[model samples]
Target: MMSISPHQVISAFDEVPTVGHCLVACITITSVLYGLYQWLLPNPVPGIAFNLEATKSLFGDAPGMIKEVSVTGEFRVWCAKQVKKMDSPICQVFIRPFSKPWILLADFRESKDVLMRRKEFDKSSFLSDGMECMGSFHGIYPTGDKFKWNRQLIQDLMTTSFLNNHVGPAVYSKGLDVMKLFEMKMNLAKGRPFSVKKDFEYASLDVMIEFAFGKNWVHTATGPQVELLSKLGASEVKFDALDQPVSFPIAPIMDFLESVYEAPEIVEKTINAIMPKLQTWWWSKQSWYKKIFDEKERIMKEQVAIAVNNYRSGHVKTGIEHMLMREGARAEKEGREPDFGSEVFRDEMFGDIVGGHHTTSGAMMWLAKYLTDWPQIQSKLRLVLYETLSTAKEENRLFTFEEIRRAKLPYLDAVIEEMLRINAVTVTREALCDTTILGCPIKKGTQIFFVSNGPGFLSPSIPTDDSKRSETSRAAKLNDKWDETHDLTLFDPERWLVRKNNGEGLLEDDVDFDGAAGPQLAFGLGPRACWGRRLAHMETKTLIAMLVWNFRLLETPPALSSHAGFEGIARVPQQCYLRLSKI
Candidate 1:
């Protein structure tokens, strides 16, 4: 070969890689590849349809959902739209990075079966974790001994005896207060629409507070506002606009009401967050959060003390007193001291106040919006109410709680059911073990969100492979199909009425209300379904009856009547404006 100089040999050796350099280079390449495989890539459960592009990205479905929420301010609608987008009754959505994908199930039959009969599913950690900040014990607990015990504690609150005898009058009286406030506003508006959202919230808070605390609990939000408004004449009360909806000043909310109102907002934020526990911790450290937490604690303690004293004096009438009595009975039976101040007791009381007020308020707000939109339905409903409660109408007085409850007015039922169907509530369930949903294998620990606004409830259902469905779901007798003759998406009350032919060989107007006439999960289903179902129905019906019976909900401008919703603990309407004419 040729003569090689020492300098050339040294230069060649210097260019060669050393062991230390090779080790560092190998580690850097391994880390990048590992990150792409583990963190950046979207690994989905097999056999479940998912967005192809979503699977290619590191953020997967989260970026799309976040963008949708940011633009529309509706997370609930975005959730339901994913099922339609996938064109599958059951689909996978990878939202949380590096975590298991969420299963979005749209089939009502499978959903019902899973909620009602399937033992493999239970309350997911997704729900419990979001609510854990409230307390250790409540209805959000997974199906277990703890959940059962919690249910037993508050089971009596929903009893027919307690609801009719105790809660009915309180809710009715509150409803009257709301009507009174609206009547005053109607006079001031002189045909202009006024925002009734705060009125609804205040009234609901009043009812729920009395229910949880007691009739003796005198801290009333609406009561004070109503009193304050009464002092001011029609001229004194100012309006921002004559043609559009007027915004009126509301009374300062009590610490208790403020705390309850704020708790759900925090819960919503934590649930939607990527890191819920960390988010909750951060929230817990905030001054506002601490104030609300402490305020709630102070109010609960004060109310419980009052309730205990009342119970001793044989004045037990509210939900908390009933709970204390239950604990006492349990303590007597078990021969141990009743833990009246237990976390379970406090949390359950607070939970009821939080959930009860929000759910009822949302439904009522929506009912007002619907009434304004469908004047024919509203007039028909009003006529039905007038005829059904002729005795009260003739007397020029509102119907009694018992009278409304005892009435067999099918149209009223149809209206409420339709409202509920169109505003279907979402329920989330977790696969307790490895299971198959609609024939697709769902891994254990998967969170399956049951949304009612999609598929069978509000839109045409996605094509499902019936052969793949579980045996129970396929054979479910309670799987009732919707009548697609009418647009399933429209807000039509007649869809819930069962019209039969008379002996004259003609269709009769005497239709009976059939709640099972279609697919809906408004209050959920199964044993774990909303225990507050009866309470919610009664409150909504009574309030709707009272409002329709007392005033006609005149239509407002399109801007004032927008059906856009803000998804919180419930999907409440953004606008609940009403132009009222006293009957």
Candidate 2:
């Protein structure tokens, strides 16, 4: 079913000889037959078949995903609707025309089963291969022995102690820098709507860079736009949804990394089949890819050089450095050579930066937008923050590290959980071998996406079987902490609150988020979940508190909200032009 028509047609035109013409005709006709065969092939898996027509693209679903998904943030909501409408917790959807349909599991129980059965379903090499195309292979997208090996070092570096003593303090320090920049923007605004996004980005990147390389690069990397966001746009735009187009600078790198999300057929098989030769050809001369790739590797090598020099001088300050040291020691003890120079190790650090940088920022941005959008929820959260971090009131400033670290704030915890659920981060996996997920014949090498939003939404409603009961009452009975509002479409932090049945909406303790499987797949499920999730939570809550304490962020035009489209490997918040008033 692979394409061969163009080459054969070319070959036929090149010669008029009888033998050559006949061969070309045969090849061209055979290619047509093969393509038709693939086109007419039936679904290989046994399940209810559904396809998002918009998700169809030249590269299969990838383009549709970019247009309707990464840009608009509609994928999760649509999936949740489909699961509810069909009444099937698990279903199948074609990734592209003529590609094997991948399974989509919406029910928590089945999804958890699929997640736990790692022997049959594990991380795919589709992204691993794409990373190689960029410059090097990454441990972020791998399975089996390689994942375990990389994981050991990652675990040591992201341990609780490292986060508390190092990463936490570092984030707080950078967050203060962000607060200062926000002050500049506020002064320039004179009570107007402006984007703190650039400052937000710098702060997140600043923390991550220091965490990864023991250095701060935000001040140097920040653009003039940071100081001018307020004056560039009018204050009127913040009162309502601004419907104008806003340019995103991060599009290119996001597009480059986007191959990781391509359909199983296109990326998993086709890219692997075609890219290596093309890569070899393009890399030889002054091609666009060659120049970009060179620049990328150049940056990585430069950082690696600095990090190594610092380590030798007893100046290691980043988690990466600690990870490498632990890994090196372990390798020495095992009498095996450590691989600091390997492409895998180098890319692992790159992966951390790429993975951590915008994602945390994007999540924080969304949390901010939601806080603005959901004013009632904001009031509740503010109350919780004030009561929990009461030490802050002494000076009426940002919460200290110790105050922020004080035991869990139920509303705050619930808000973070709900934000992640609504803005679900997707994880893609391929069947490690021929296997069945929930009795469906999952073909080998089929890339399946495990989405958190669908299950996270559904789990809160699943345990209660009485549909006759009010949705709110049923959902509350199942897990009262945050089910006060049953409208899943809206942002409700109270959904994570414990419900006490006393003829009134009463919230008690915080839900056990760490162990909660159904709704709390923010870091994903089972062993292959996100390694940096704890740090993600810590930084997000800390940054959120910093923002909330310093100012009262009012609503933006819907056009410049978290729901706005900003396309990339992941969906990001765009044009968040909130009205910021100093508290």
Candidate number achieving the greatest lDDT relative to the actual structure: 1
List the candidates' TM-scores in order.
0.93, 0.75
lDDT per residue for candidate 2 within 1-583, as digits (tens), equals 6777888989977766688778999999999988766565544455554554523333444454435554454565555555565555555654444656656666444555566545677765544554444333334445657667666666656778878878888788877767766666665456556676655666776676667766523332233434444344544333423333233222122322222122111222323232434544554465554555555456656666666666668766676677667667887999998766666555666566666767687788888888898888777677667766667766676788767866467567778877877766555677878866545567788877665565446444433234433233234424324442366666765555554353332223423333352255556676676767788888988988888878888766665664763423344576566677788
Worst 10 residues of 1 by lDDT: 500-509
lDDT of 1: 0.83
Off by over 4 Å in 1: 1-40, 239-241, 478-481, 501-509
What local lDDT score does residue 506 receive in model 1, on the 0 to 100 scale?
A: 11
**The CA-based lDDT of model 2 is what?**
0.60
Task: Score each candidate by Cα lDDT.
Answer: 0.83, 0.60
- Strongest candidate by TM-score: 1
User: What total of clashing residue pairs does each candidate reach?
Assistant: 0, 12
lDDT of 1 at 103: 91
Query: Which tens-of-lDDT digit does each residue in 467-570 have in candidate 1?
Result: 98788877878634467656887888888777764431111257777788888788888877777878888888999899999898887988888888877667
